[model samples]
Target: MCTVCGCGDGEVKVHGHKHHSHDHSHTHSHSHDDGLHFGDGAAGVSVPGYSQERLIKIETDILAKNDRYAELNRAKLAAQEVFAVNLVSSPGSGKTTLLCKTIEALGGQPLAVIEGDQQTQNDADRIRATGAPAIQVNTGKGCHLDGHMVGHAIEHLTLSHGSLLFIENVGNLVCPASFDLGEDCKVAILSVTEGEDKPLKYPDMFTAARLAILNKIDLAPHCDVDLDLYTANLRRVNPTIEILNLSARTGEGMSEWITWLRTNLAQKQLQGAAE
Candidate 1:
């Protein structure tokens, strides 16, 4: 289980490996008063019978192991000049739709997707429908995709050199921020229908993301959402984060996103060549 979020780390099944299972069990306790105050300790997470020092050590060890796996994943992708992007967002943020539109807009680009969810291969099916090769990873009871899971997913994909690889992470703004999937960058998507204070409420996600996409901008007026406020909040949390406003449904402001992708891909290829 994830000591940070207390989410069960059950079996993680990558597509084509139905019999594979990983059991990650840990002992932790949660207490509720007025609300769950799990962020009061030095480790920033509370667990009964564990001292702050112990908790910190546990978290550090876990992240260190994850980082090692992430480095392996990164090296593998870099060797092929594959630019991987980790798309993260809360549920109902139109992430899958955006990914579909992105694939369509890229035209004949060589790209693949790795879809992550707690259950079902619905999103992966949608991507495959667009005629792109996609692999579905079902993280049963796991809140987010980790480096180890992504690395395994890559083995199933015959990624082309200098192609783009998109990893659509499980819909959760909290735990995904703490996990790295060896992507070149993390893109956090937020819809206008959601609260403008989402950045404030989930500051860690925004801070961790390299870019923030404010999706569903076409419905901003109808949703009574101030686009500027959302941008301001994102900048407040991550001053250096690249922000893009676009609607996948309306095909508006999509050109900018495509250009960003192309530019990043070129840079990644250049880096690989230099190495």
Candidate 2:
């Protein structure tokens, strides 16, 4: 039985196997985690099921556990009264640069950032230059930031109440959408240089984002990209996604971005107050 949405919670007792009663509680999701182990190990003692089904089941179980932790973390964040945004973008999408500019635009406020990267502390260094508390989590080989990792980073930073926490998730759109890091919202940034077809091609990222920033509009004229089409594609995926066309380098449209941030923060604060 799967631990989440509970479907596969059956018990397993192998033939000619002697073991204590297996606890059927918390039926973890594994493709083969439905139980019933057959055959034997090299030692002639079957250690439960070890089939391909089991592997899939184990993988599902792991992700389910991650999501459970994520929910717990989200409730904790709600209690803390923080406006946390999980920002997702691809490599060279100007995520860090845009973040630095956003920090400046926000007037050096108490914004704490969690930088995620497979390697290098470059992004953290850039954020630190802006005088905000930036904690860089090096995933080393991981492509995205999971809820558990973000939870660990938040605990490490000792993030106080009423602070803006930006999680610059590892530069990937695919896996990040599946895991929530207890954020108030998820923001996705797509540079114009990446072309207008991104939203259509990467529907998951666009759909997951509460806001989609079409960055580097300063280079829009240089690229043969149709802004309207791009927006339409995104709108098709998520009709209510707030779209922002901005250039981080030229500072054009940044004020609007800042205003959006302020509004989001204000709304989050109000929600917290009401709660």
Q: List the global CA lDDT of all models.
A: 0.84, 0.73
Candidate 2: residue 172 lDDT (0-100): 83
Please give the RMSD of candidate 1 to the true structure: 5.1
User: Which candidate number has the best lDDT?
Assistant: 1
Model 1 per-residue lDDT tens digits across residues 96-120: 9999999999999999899999888
lDDT of 2 by residue, 149-262 (tens): 677666656557777889999888676876778888899999988877788777878899999998998888888778898789999989999999999999999999899888
Which regions of candidate 1 fall more than 4 Å away from where they truly are? 17-45
Question: Model 2 reaches what TM-score against the true structure?
Answer: 0.79
True-structure lDDT of candidate 2:
0.73
Worst window of 10 by summed lDDT in candidate 1: 27-36
